[model samples]
Target: MKRVASTLHQGALLGLLCIPVAQAATGDAGSDAGTQASPTLKAVTVTATRREESLQKVPVAVTVLDGETLERDNRNNVSSIVQEIPTLNYRPSASNKDSSLFVRGIGTISTSPGVEPSVATVVDGVVYARPGQSTLDLLDVDRIEVLRGPQGTLFGKNASAGVLNIVTRDIPEQTHGYVDYAHYGGGDENRLRFGIGGRLSDTLKGSLTTSVGRYDGNVENVTNGHEVNGYERKGVRGKLEFQPRDDLKLTLIGDYSDGENDTPSVVVKPSAAVAAGISPVVPGNSNRKISSDYKTYVDDRNQGLSLQADWSLANDFTLTSITAWRGWNNSQYQDNDNLAALPVTAVHDKGTVDYDQLSQEVRLTSPKGQFVEYVLGTYLFHGKSDETYRRLSVTNSVGNTGVADYSATNDSYAVFGESTFNFRSDLRGIFGLRYTLDQIEYDHRRVSTSAVEVNSIRPSYASSGSHTDSGISGRVGLQYDLSDNLTSYITYSRGYKGPAYNVYFNMQATDVQPLDPETSNTWEVGLKSSAWSNRLTANLALFHSKYENYQANFYDVVGTSVVTRLINAGSVTSQGVELDYALQATRQLKLSGSLAYTQARIDQFACPSGAAASCDINGKPLPFTPDWKSFVRADYDIPLDNGLDVELGTDYSWQSKVQYSLDQNPNSEEGAYGIWNASVGLADYSKGWRVALVGKNLADKAYAPVLSTGTSTTRIVPRDDRRYFGVQLHKDF
Candidate 1:
């Protein structure tokens, strides 16, 4: 075995080089140690953990996608981001404007406005509660980190599955700014993203960035008597930083997004409709006439404001606090079918949410002679969320006839403590515990107006619920440093998620109880190493998790007016292996790839199991669980005379077919498919300006990014298989 330096040390050495010439000329001790620097690998990331650690040295399994890579790939939407991360998948629903996200094998399939997501997305420290906001385009983001596995102890709330943290670029103390513009040949895809930032004073800085994208619909609306197609979107984000002193810092951020999606609808198949006991859509009717025009066009808007502060109490301790408020509104139509046979359903949603969360934490480390390093924190969260869903039944494309309203309010407080002991030089033990008390008040009201009924029925109910759950979660790991660069460790932790309010379209009986929170236990072991003259870095980890009483949506055999309800299933177990490797073949050549093999299934699940002899799911793979998925990306830049450079790169992903529906429909599985993307560009690396030609779906592979199983009509978006060539220009001032 060869001695390898830790990934953190390697990054620190690289940062010290500064263009490789100064250190080379000085013959510094750091420069004499190893591998030559590479120009293609200039981006740096620090989202591996709460700490500011280098991407390569982070102990956890993470994927880094910088803004430059996002631009070069011409990936301006959420769909494009998922293509590079094979372990992620999503499904579209009427409840969510965009598709609901799923990582590994856990995610919500029901787009019901009431169902909460299992995964958590954190922007700068503020947790985005709604699924619609998760897909918002990247905005002045410094880096995006996708942390795999349960992160409840650190991220809190719905992070039982994982966490997607978007870290925006901080305001630099120097004057700098950038503007970008791009144009696509197909669908007239046009985009503009620009931002400016500068130091107003030695202790004050601010930045503002805005992005807008629009395009004409590629599909024509033959029945609407006009071209019913394409989409338009606009987004803006701004931030300001105040640092009155070197030891304290306060930051404020605000963001807004509004967009319209004109994506066409996929027709429902006859078999699926018959299975759901719904009549097929009549032929010769436009999608709008059959399912309503709203489904064809999605109108979405969101706004967020947050504040973060950090105070360095002492050299061995620090204090931090975060507060935020967020709101989301979405109005969309779902064309249940391409034909007009069935009635069209139009839905309008109005939601307002305000959260006031205050967290106080003090981290103290061992001083010169101390042996105990500890962390203590107290958190208080107050939230009031009111959501109203208006569902209208349109006949001959008429107005709304009925409306459904759902709302909830929640208050939570917790106190937690953790401490690490240096039992030995080669072994460290971590122990932590947290106690939480949460109160929730739920109100559900539904009103219907029809010619058959002279006066509409107003059914309303309210409930006051409180639950106190106390649990202990901790990690025990042993790290044996064989050398300065090589280390290995094993850890185990148990985490729990608190139950949340479930909003139902129809009123529920007072006797019925809401779903309980989920509990999970995870065991993992991993190794990190860097070798081969410091040009190659490899990381591997294996983990197994077991969850009890998982919440799932199912139809009630005895219910009326409502189609689905939430219930807890017995148990589920998941296990997987992950591997990542990055190698610098040469100073200008680089290669990086990641592989994940996962097995997620219902260990003992018992659904309604409708009375069908052939329908048996005793031991079957869970829905939407892709067994094998991998990503490979490589790029090389060739420097030429003068200040010009040419860079070429490509990446590919292969996903195995997985079940898409809980009904176990054989046709619901999406078959294995591979997508290839390539890009070429010329730029001056020394200066901050560049031009690039990017192409997505170079092979024009037609595939459904998300297969919609809403109701009887199962429509699949025949993803645009046409090649889209685009040019991008960027300048920094």
Candidate 2:
């Protein structure tokens, strides 16, 4: 604790020192007369509070990335975006079907089909219930807003940690279109992306986007002289918007993606005792390579369709409805033993999931200039999902296999209202509340084909159950406009997540138990300022959150097999501070930076069923929770006498070390690392043509994104995309 305090103190001092430098460059104290007009900062508007408002006045901790910034940073996917967000982390497991997203150390480790993610992801006002669905490629995005801390009052359930809101480009009124193409090389990788959009008619518009990419594996298989982790993927998305009436709008979207790749290459690092009997493989010694005798592969397919409608009503109100359906299928083959000598054990697993959801919301809003501006709304959601999993294992010419099928039906309803009271010109009070009810029905069946003796010990099982839960979440805050250029706010909020069933059930029916709900309370304070004639903007937030009945997933050894189970752990606490700044130093140069510090620890916890020992983890930091993270970015543009523009930009980011597992195993630790990227571009706006050259990981830093420890060996997933350069071209018509 003392070390963390010291680090925070030092950071604070550094930030204070920067103020003078900024003042010296921009003359901060010369504005007393208010005679010289200053350039107004670009207005930033967001819908984080369920209504459109200025980001500086929303009284929430939110980070907004505009389309131009995203393109400049090469954040075309969720995984890549995590590199710039201080509080976000994306860790993909070996299966590749599940992606764990941690926000401020409060995130779900389980990837079960039935479990809900703590951090909710919403695109174009439609929530994606599955984490895998949130990993889709980003295309034609207008803006993205990341709201930190609990946001249950407005975003609905499964938002105990935070929320990721993505807004795609909307149809324009004019008949215009654009085409873009990009090619990437080096590191034995290639990617191509293109898109076109335009108004189809006076009241109709549409867009189509597609991308195809391939990467030759960097790791070599010594046994076969072939790449072990090479893969290719392609995706296409189409959207149509119809505006039949001035007050009504409708949109239709369809998308599909397919990918095939070799199973991830995993290097085994056995303990000394375990290595005495077997050979140990070091990562860097052999160019971080590995050898597998089995010819393993993974195939994945995803498709989705959605429809949204919005209608403007009288009294400044609106009505919205969203209907969506999605499907996923994945198959994998692997050598479980991870040895080249012989295939002592091999496994094949396949899963398919189908989901459909319908949601409706109606909101009423009062005028903004009134003494009290209020918003009231009611929400309804209904969803159904079905999943099937099949696994086969072979050893010593004998095979063991099992098939588990699961299904779930869910219905949820909520009523919420929020109001802001303007006591005076510079002071305001805000309060909001939401009451939610959720009901879920689940069913599971498992069948196995094995010897009679094995079947007797682990027979087929079936179970069916239902659960209903209700909760209340709310927020209270106060905002004070210190001056025309500055504002400060403090808030307290509560968040909730509903109960869920264990989706990976393969044992006796009795072993399939439902986990309880989880809740969090957070307190936060923030400051937002625009200074130096709007050339500089800064935002800072400090927060603390306490959680109860935190849902956790762990491996449980039942009889002779291992299975994942969800349980309600006791308590946890997280405290953090975030800082963001943007400066338009001059007409040609722009700079931006962000920094974060977090201390998340388990307040109380007990070992689960399959733990190495029954020990307490009281004070241990959460997995993947780094203590410090920072980023710096700069962009400069130069105009030539020939009406051409040349732009140069760069980004650098770094993070502290982090543990990979709940046990905090020393062997599962990943060291801190930094990455640098740069780009150069030329544009002729009058001719509607532009081209750019981009490079990533220019320093060629090597690191591991994920690591895990097994009974006898440790598995590490290394990121080998050391360096890559790409070219992009765009044309408008």
Candidate 3:
């Protein structure tokens, strides 16, 4: 049955992608009131190569989202933004700290703090050690660049899978400000955002942005009268600049945020509950409801400061320096059992984390337009964090299982350089390399505090360990201009990640040893083209990657209880084809679409210690990765005689069924689903004011993004679990 569903979904994806660009090329008008000339698509600029360049000319796979487009799409944060991007995925967890990012089905799921994320996020000039920090409600962002594949040489700190380069808005030359408000009816969600920027002095400028919002939640908790899955969040971001000379400029950035939200979602499946001797909820219920005795919540706070300096040197060379410090603290309470009435085997968990990091980077770049251009830099980072977890469970009887405390520290140093050789007017060769050394240490201890006896997930133990390692990674590629508006490129890259430790609450004697480092080798071929007199743009990329010592989760079946532990898998492989295109069909109409077909699977499996005979998952597809995904977006506007513009936009995103568990349990699969969002607005360009009505999940689709099954099944129902409507108002001064 599932296979049949998958086949149908695959057809839908292809049907959507293979039909659009051809019709758009005919220059069809969105409005019948006009005989206007066809408009050319605007040229896009990107910093994917750490330098400003035309998007179509860069020899890499990158998707650029500008500020205006983001606002029009109603995407406020990283999670929402990933939904429309090809091969990009986000996983929410019981707590923000456990959430993760993945590109091309390649990412790490462990929350050990001892392993670095395969994909990294860089905001302005600062790199966030934790990807969860990227969720901090970014303020007044100028643009976001998603660079796919290994960017080790230029990005440096273990971006083996991909990089999310975020650039915030710059200070305005003249005083300016804006305000925006939005209200959603279905979830009873409200959002208010405002920003101000201008010149502060003859040689200085400044800007400030703030966002505040709240939601009543969509899910109902039957155990308690109160609604569950709600959130209240607020944040502030500001920046300042000083220009002592025309050749030198310095900028300082600061931001802070605090919020309290419930668990990602702990709704129990009805069939799973009944099978375990409980009531209410089917395996695929569409009620958007949950049953939990204990309330779940996560209180989080984050703040950061960064300083960047740019100085032009002799011979048109430029030097850059960035220094930053960031901190994140959060506490989580979870109703792990996900049952209205406590069963014989139920569990409750509480955890807290305190983390901070400081980093400094200096780089030098050669002048552009030269025969050979190069970027050389050195990066240093130090991160430290401590965690505490406590749990209570019932098995035959109730017992306060244990309290686990753990701390970890990471230090990294690297020097990287990338150079492009312009061999001819239309041909270029790229070469890059990076060398890094990493040192990590951790200490963990667990103890039971119960009168009922020594009861817990794992035996209480104390352990401490440290590891040090070093490696080199680089890339080689070639770019050629096939025509004035067409380009082709091919590249091969090697990615590296340092050794890791399984430093979690359940620290056993056997886990004292560290896991080996993970690495990958990837190859990519791509073509970028623009046609219809530069009114239509199309790009395609094909990539394949093989990874060794893949960091993943394996299970240990001990006395009828399955305990999960982090380990190094033998091998894994991911390959995919990505297609992106945009067409300016008319002066008032624009069309854009993307499609991705990814095949991610385990090539070799490593069984848990002492569980060899029971483990066999070698050819299984990776979790959270769908076989096919695609999206289509359209926007149109009609200008009135009085200078007002009426705008209409719609976007549809779809994905094939996805598995949410590493153990490959069929019960943990989410069926293929599609979300359709639409909006209509009226705006006065001269007055800088606008109003709009937005509809999300217009078809009332129901789906879960995350799922976990133990004594009971728990899953995360996304924010767009049902149809919702919103009103948006904006003004500028």
Candidate 4:
């Protein structure tokens, strides 16, 4: 309690100190602005509803961030962006191929190839089928929109929770380029990014972007006398746009990314019995250091190509086609025991997944002056993936190995339509619907062998199966314009996720089974207001969702080994309230904040048979769902006499206690924590140059991002980059 109080006090003091400086600067500059008008907040446009519209007029609960804001705040990746959004959470897996993301208490916990993410990740207009692809580096991005609700009707399948839409920068007709460099304090961490765009001919334009980044590990391996968890990545992207006529356009995009890093290190927090038998804990070991007997590593490669075409037809009709091919290959090795003792247990996983997708969409949009505006669209998608997995567990006396080859294909078709009826000048009724059909087929084969262990040997197994399902999802809403500055809406929506298969390969192949599909129904009420002459914007949303046939990952102790399997739980419920506000206090000062309260629980669930332990988990909080989250940010600009400006900014975020596993054991809980970050910079926009110094986790707080429960011990992955400072420089031409 005392610590929390102290941190809050510090944050308040910082805010107080910065506000007066901004006020004084504004007062002094008023003398020269006699004829100038006060600044107002600019209108933000988003495509969250599948059409370009003003954010303030949209009826959905959404958050939008432009490229300028992201660059100014030094948010370089998806994980960092989650901190600013109150309703989102991100956790890195043991390997880069299986990160976890949760929105509104609904997400995917399993990293198997067969399982799909609940929150759809859409780049441009194409959805990434695998979560690993969503973790790619952000480069040349124009804007990002986070929609916090079921988006099944417009986004198609696998959108039960929400949607993350990313729009990349397009090729410009004029020639332009920029370069950026950043260097971090401690252990020589650095990054570089460059981009160029120009027109090759009257009808042809192209743009190219590339980035290279490297960071030293923050964790030290005491046993091996080496650093662990370091990372290096390289990426390149190219885009070409061709315009044969005024109403027809075509775009081609290709990208390649390669990254290698040390596997995430685990710090053991054993039970009382296990702790008593081991040596005394080292002083100052904390979560930043580990003692491991074996080495850990990961290597990943990804590449993709996409072609998009759009054509305008008569009477406001449009046709669109997208074709894409993406592939991922990864190899990972980890020291599972997380100890320096002999007879250690280690694991190696190597797999490759190749995906090809083709989609076509056609929409007929009614004119704006009509009493009823409507849009009708049809979509078709087909994708196929081939995956090969090899896992090895080695000990002093025996080596256990398992190899699996799997292939899957999916075909989805949907017809969707939405319309808005203007009953009055200030009232509107919105309705939408989508009918979808999905067909999936899979084939799997696995073989296991063990040396020096007669009982561990198992026969080779092969299986093939197919399934088909269909469903209807839709949305209904009513929006009222209360005034020029305030708008309110109420909505109800339904969403769905397709069925999946268990892809884990092991000696006990008999335990695997196909999992059922999941569905969700959500109701939301929201209010959006712009006050103080459009200088302040505030939004509030209250939502409730019920899920049926919830898919979950279960861990069971089979004989002497632990196995993971997918199952369909009975039901789950989630309710939450979210608030977001932004204020332009003055021409040179800006403030923004968000707060969310979520209560997500499993209404009914029963443990499956043939497991080491069996019990009911009724009325338990879902995994990775925090009770409360809040964030606040302040930015102030100080004008200088020489056409230069100094910018000062600070932000603070807090999250309540969270459960890392479904079991809800006391050891799996993480206590509440807060983080603070600050930055100072000097910029001259006319000259296209800027320099900034940024600091993160100024209080040097220690926390764990993930916790794993083993057979007898619990391991935690600590959040890296503690109390670090960095300098960033940017140049443009």
TM-score of each: 0.84, 0.90, 0.93, 0.90
lDDT of 3 by residue, 324-402 (tens): 9999998989876666556565568899989999999998999999999999999999999999998877766555577
Give me the runs in candidate 2 sitting further than 4 Å from their true place: 1-42, 228-230, 261-265, 271-287, 293-298, 340-343, 450-459, 505-510, 558-563, 711-720
Error of 3 at 461 (Å): 0.7
Residue-by-residue lDDT tens digits, candidate 4, 1-733: 8478546744643453343344334443233333347666778888786778989988999988777678656676776787788788876776766677788888877756667788878887778777777777778889989999788766644477888888888787789999999887654678899999999998899999999988777777776668767779899999999989977889999889888877554545664533433334332224556666666676777788888887787766666666666776666666555555545444445656666666665556666656788777777777777777776665554567777778878788888878889999789999999888888777878777742322222345688777788888889999998765678899999877887776655424444556777888999998887655556677888999999988886666533555556778678999988877787788899998887888999998857766443346688888888878888999999999999999999999888899877767666677888889899999998899999998888987777666666643344443334788889999999
Residue 732, model 3: lDDT of 97
The worst-scoring run of ten residues by lDDT in candidate 3 lies at 27-36
Candidate 2 lDDT, tens digit per residue, 1-733?
A: 7498567756763574355345646565444423444434477889998788888778889988887577655566676687778888777654555677788888887756666789888887767776767766676788889999877666644477889988887766665567666766643656666677778887899988787777766666666778756668889888999999988889998888888776454655554533432334454412345555666666777777778887887865566666666666666565544556433444455666666667665566666777898877777777777777776665545667778888887788888888899999889998989888988888888887853324112446788888889888888999998776678899998888888777663645444677777989999998887666667778888999999988876555544444455778778899988887787776688888877888999999856655553346689888888888888899899999999999999989888888877767676677788989899999999998889998988998877777666543344343334777888787878
Q: After superposition, which runs of candidate 4 have C-alpha atoms over 4 Å from their true positions?
A: 1-36, 271-285, 340-348, 450-460, 507-513, 612-614, 712-721
RMSD of candidate 3 to true structure, Å: 3.9
Order the numbered candidates by lDDT, best leading.
3, 4, 2, 1
| Predicted structure with the largest lDDT when compared to the true one | 3
Which residue pairs clash within candidate 4? none
> Candidate 3: global Cα-lDDT?
0.82
Clashes of each: 11, 0, 2, 0
Candidate 1 TM-score to native: 0.84
**What are the lDDT figures for the candidates, one per model?**
0.61, 0.73, 0.82, 0.75
Clashes of 2: 0
